[model samples]
Target: MAKYKIKINPKNLPVFDKYWHYQKSVQSPDIDVKFFRKAYKEIFDKHAVLLREDFCGTFKLCCEWVKLRERHEAIGLDLDPEPLAYGKENYYPKLNSKEKDRLVTSEQNVLTAKLKKPSDVTVAVNFSYFIFKERQVLKEYFQNVYDNLGDQGLFLLDIFGGSDIFDLPEEETEFEDENFSYYWDQEDYNPILNHGLFHIHFKRKGEKKRKNVFNYDWRVWSIAEVRDILTEVGFAETRCYWEGTDKDGEGDGEFKPSEKGEAHCESFVAYVAGIKK
Candidate 1:
């Protein structure tokens, strides 16, 4: 009897799209819209007409903003071409002509980008500004945002912190419907500098794990410290929006302005908004 060899066919293997996976797992554009708009109305007692999204990977937030109202406009700024191209090809095409005209994006740095008009709101979420580990650089970036905002404008950013962030080595989240697993690997941390190395990896079902889908070298900034820097950089006032907890102690998806945060959680995410005088 002849022995037959078992073959592994490449065509039958699983495929992974990191950006697609990231949007599903991490971003909630609809929620961001509600928060941004509501926060604006609460702070300034008026509607925000234009928004600028700094370090806006894929510009999904900008796309969503234009959809909110006919007069609403959005601008997205980023230095990378790959994600910008990805947004142009994927998300931009989904918008109608009116929204397409209302939304604009540029391949430029947040620190020096020039816009035709100042934005009513500028957002840098997902801890993207943590890239500026130095206090001076971060303050400089904040000052630029301050100078570029319209009167009564606001700058919003999201940050995560807790005792566990420094201690947790790694975390894995599985999406059964998407047929993949996401991993956040905290490879290194320096207590002295408050800096950390993080990597995002993905594993498709029945496939080998992919490493370093995204990587970040960031200094973990405290909420208090960030507020101080915003004030020092010329923001008239700084506010924190703390997320409420459900019965199970998980974030209940509602954020209200608060000066004091709740006690003792493994990790928490909150928004800090800087109001221009």
Candidate 2:
């Protein structure tokens, strides 16, 4: 066997280490909670309350969202049931009755899911909407979101791309603390349509490297394409919140609205907000 420049943690830990160790540790729910509050209060002056998380795998954010207020309610919709069960076992158990009562998880497709009442804030983070590879399909999903919004509501989602994102074969990231190196393998990319295949692998020090821990076949949609779709969906206005990097040139986990961004290393993340009419 040969070794690459990276190693991934195998997630063999008996107690469901994949979500907590890999996803939750790196994910910043504090940032999410903050943005949801700011974006809501900024628009409706503390009137927004109900939140819907589309493609809410595991609904981790939903668990955190309800904690923001006793009155706050969250609805998480996703096609997959595994993560939802895991959230029930791990995150849901940790919350009190009132908090747990405020959260709702539905195992349904996001495109077809219906909200009893219009949501004040709805989000599709981690670029989950990338599953829709075609422009029309993506626009329909955005339109669904727009229709599901309350008066003065907001639709938010994250997008990331750079010169490096396209035309790249593979890239590796090393995390020494966890004794693993994460790989963002860009197996293929199409310049004509900006579609691609991506995989995540992990290598543990002195252990056999794990390949394809997770795989994603995404469209690699651009900011312009997404912005255009939001407008087509009849959103009154749209905004992009670019991320700031720290002194070490790593994502500082902070996002602020901006019109322009500078180029960066292998990968990056940011949010696109659509204001409902």
Worst ten in a row by lDDT for model 2: 1-10
CA error at residue 48 for candidate 1, angstroms: 0.4
List CA RMSD, all candidates: 6.8, 5.9
Q: For this target, which candidate reaches the highest TM-score against the unseen true structure?
A: 1
lDDT of each: 0.89, 0.80
TM-score per prediction, in order, is 0.94, 0.87
The superposed Cα distance between candidate 2 and the true structure at residue 213, in angstroms, equals 1.6
lDDT of 1 by residue, 136-236 (tens): 99998998899889989999999998878778568899999978898989898899999999999988888899999999999999999999999998889
Write down the lDDT that model 1 would get.
0.89
Residue 82 Cα positional deviation in candidate 2, in Å, after optimal superposition: 1.2
In candidate 2, what are the lDDT values of residues 1-277, reduced to their tens digit? 1111123447744432455544633466656977878877876676568899998877889988998887889999988777787777767888899998889998888877788888999999888899999888888898888888987889999998877776676766787887777776888888887888887777777767678777789998878789889998899998888889899888787788889888555666888999985
